[model samples]
Target chain A: MNLDLRLDTSGDFYARKFQPTKREDTLILNMGPQHPSTHGVLRIILEIDGEYILRAEPVLGYIHRMHEKMAEVMSYPQYLPNPARTDYLHGLAWNWAHVAAVERLMGLEVPERAEYIRVITCELNRITSHLLWWGAYLLDLGAFTPIMYAFDDRERIQDILQRITGSRLTYCYYRFGGVSNDIDDRFIEETRKQCSRMKPRFKMFKDLVTDNFILRKRVEEIGEIPADTCRKYGATGPVLRGSGVPYDVRRAEPYSVYDRFDFNIPSYDTCDAMGRYLVRMDEMQESIKIIEQALDTLPEGDYIMPKAPKKPKPPAGDVYFALEGARGKIGFHLVSDGDKSPYRLKLRAPGFSNLSLFSEVSEGVLIADAVSILGSLDLVIP
Target chain B: MSEENAKPEKAPDKEKEVKKKEEPQVPKYTGYDYDCFLAPQELLKAVTKLDHADFFLEDVSCVDMQEGFQVVYHFDRFSQPGRVVLRVMISRENPEIPSIYDIFPGAAWHERECFDFFGVRFTGHPNLIPLLLDPEHQGPPPLLKEETALKDLNQLYPDRVHTPVSPDSEEFVKEINNCSNQKSRNQS
Candidate 1:
């Protein structure tokens, strides 16, 4: 047998079909369905003229698990674990959106204490998410030390969360009307300690990472996305705030006890990767503020509603619920036909919209800056 | 094929439209500030109106019902937060609706997702390929209900009316303009 050792010159179906410009010198490149900078299995096909990108298109669906389809077949309680799997970084927010949507549809009244618990735990989870994004983003831009610092804080928060939430990363602690486990004094005390501990770390994070000339040089004035562009693509969370919109679902919509908490939605008018970077940095501090407020005023009552429906059958209608996740706004549109399972369940993953704008933003930028742009978006592709 | 099927029914629909001029009744606590049914032709116009009002498209979701395919478009504004849902019904035999990608560029991905799952074709979409489904997979759209599992409009929306409001009408324009101005649930 003759050994043939030559690379396959032809590309995959997506790359082959990717239309190239009429220019003769333009070369086609596939960034990843496995490249580390993408954070997940997201593939971006690029048309390049030397170091500059002519056009870019992202090919998704490598990790699509069809969670919406799963929601239709599973019972309400059985489907509780699915949302957390979608955006694992901010798992609690997705978990909250699922439970809150059902609660809104069935007119369930959550105990005030349970509402406060949700707020406290959810903010903690948000901190972990932003921390991970911060570390991973810095790593993407060629720095490795920050991730160690990120996971250090992340693990402590996870330890506190695990004491109550049971599991560490992909949490399913939230139930329909309230949380699964009540936070004892130990849990609250540990959380308060973590909150106070994180305050000084933010200052250190600024000195060690944010103000570093190399990191700022890599991100600042790169990938400038106008506020109008964000609206056009429906990007949300820190990406939208980074564009100077100040439109956070927590503030604009005020879900749970968020209205009672005093925290500012930080926005930067620079509209570059630096703005997006600063927004996430500022947001982690705000999360600590919200957690501190919720913990201070922690109410007294049931954690989960006493007689919450074990087998909820919402009336025949539809309800739309949206909450701000770390990456962006996570939405759930549930249509029920008076059934135990949803008639149709549609999940509005923020990363899908946030990532869609990449093809447009990545155009005409240097390939290295393109990586900077993608990292700043902080995508957890579902 | 869909255009022809939609046209013949227009004459009779207009007759029903006059009798049902009373406000479309949605449940008070359904989380929708402004909900209206629009004819397929009026969808583009209504979306354009929303774009002019500085509203951002949240998502486009489609539900399979016995009556037809109910395509839902959700929009909200940053300045004034209120959800405006536009429901348009299209025949299942030829499930086609005009794309809003031109008006709201973000909708390109959403419309593709709808097409991928429900097989609802969005006409005029630039790249209508599958966004989250395997392109080589062999099957009907995965989200389509089995014939036995489908629910009709009456069963699903028992108490509400299903009249299509023309986008050109004063009520439609006023609703689009004032949707964000309405007090949101959280504000109360």
Candidate 2:
């Protein structure tokens, strides 16, 4: 066997193609398809003049699995587990979006109890997602101890979710008309216990990290994205809320039992990295509130619809369903041709939109602040 | 630069704008509040109307239908939440459409994804290279349906009307403007 292992000194295809301006002083740098702070396989090509970045372009598709193509070939039920893989941190939201889109198209009615369960589990999942982000983001900024505290809470939620969903991450718990498994009395008791425990932990987190002078200086006013820029780029979730839009998909477009819950959409007008940090921190508390409310108002009924189709063949038409995932708005656009499988399914990953604005926001900021801005975005590159 | 030159140019443009009014079909079955079909040329104008109306672009997606390539653009507002889907049908032989990148800026990646999947050319896109596929891969676009598997617009849409609305029409402008004010499906 002949092995041609000659090193290409010029650069890879993406690097060579990402031509810098005709300036002798500027240098092109690749941040990572492997860099630690990126948190996943995200490569950012940057043109920097000394420490300040002149231009930044994110090169994607390193981990593209073509889930859309998978949906085309698979049946409705067969495609259930695919959405969860897109954003593993907030898998239930993606699962909900996929199932809810199909259910809306078929006009299947979900029992009230099922809606409450979805709300509780999904909110719990949201907290875990935020917790992981909080820890990983702080770790990216060179802090390690916060992740320990974050995981303590995260593992508990994962254990609770693992029992019902059968997996800690990338959960496929939601079904067409309802969830796959019903919650028992022990599940409720554990969730209530966790929610109560989380309240004081948040206060500790604030005093320990959020209000710390060093952490505040590192994050505050680092990446200032105006509200108008957020709208222009279609950035959502905390990224948009951090810019002070308060445009949560839950309140803006109510889905499931979100409207029934009384919770505040925490927003900051600072339009900086600290604003985003604070929003996520406050949002975890709101999730606890939502879970507590749902638990108190838990109704009794079937978890999954009795007549739910095993192999759903929705009528010929299309439906668009969106939900508030931890990252942002997770949308599923399903087109049916009166077949067991979707004719064409498109996923609107909110991280894609949120990250798109990075190129614009990262310009003129120092390289370290670029990492801060990226961390503040809390991206889960699927 | 003179008013006289602008007057003659504006006259014929006004005359050409006197096309028949077409009302967008509000199909209650679909989750969209307003669903309209537009000629490829009118996409930018319609998108500009949406931008002025304070609607944010959700995502731009494309579907390969037997009739043509249907490029779908989903938009929603923060203040008043309602989904408005714009469907532009372009010929399969030349699957080209005007890019909304200059207006939304976020459609750049979505258009590239469409190009990578279905080989749809987004004209005026600053960077139209492959976004989520291997740049060196040599094969046909992956998402194109087999000829036998193709379904026409009627088969996919069924009962919905497919009339192409003129972007310059008063009714079209009004519909785009009022789409957000209309109560969302969940609220109704």
lDDT of 2 by residue, A1-382 (tens): 7987998668877887786777789988999999999878999999999999989999988899999999999999999999999998999999999999988888788999999999999999999999999999999888999999999999999999998889999899999888899999999999999999999999999999998998988999899999999999999999999999998888877778898999999999999999999999999999999999999999999999998888988877898988899999988999988789999999999999999999999989999999999999988887
Which docking class does model 2 fall in?
A: acceptable
Each model's RMSD to truth, in Å? 7.2, 10.8
lDDT of each: 0.89, 0.90
Model 2 per-residue lDDT tens digits across residues B53-167: 8989899998899988999999998877778999999999988898899999988898999999999999999988888899997989999999999999988887678999988
What residue runs in model 1 are displaced by over 4 Å at the alpha carbon? A1-8, B1-28, B181-188
Model 2 chain A is weakest, by summed lDDT over 10 consecutive residues, at: A13-22
* Interface DockQ per candidate: 0.36, 0.33
Q: How many residue pairs clash (N, CA or C atoms closer than 3 angstroms) in each of the candidate models, in the order given?
A: 0, 0
Across B70-168, the per-residue lDDT of candidate 1 in tens digits comes to: 999999898888899999999999999999989988999999999999999999998898778988878999999998999999878766679988888
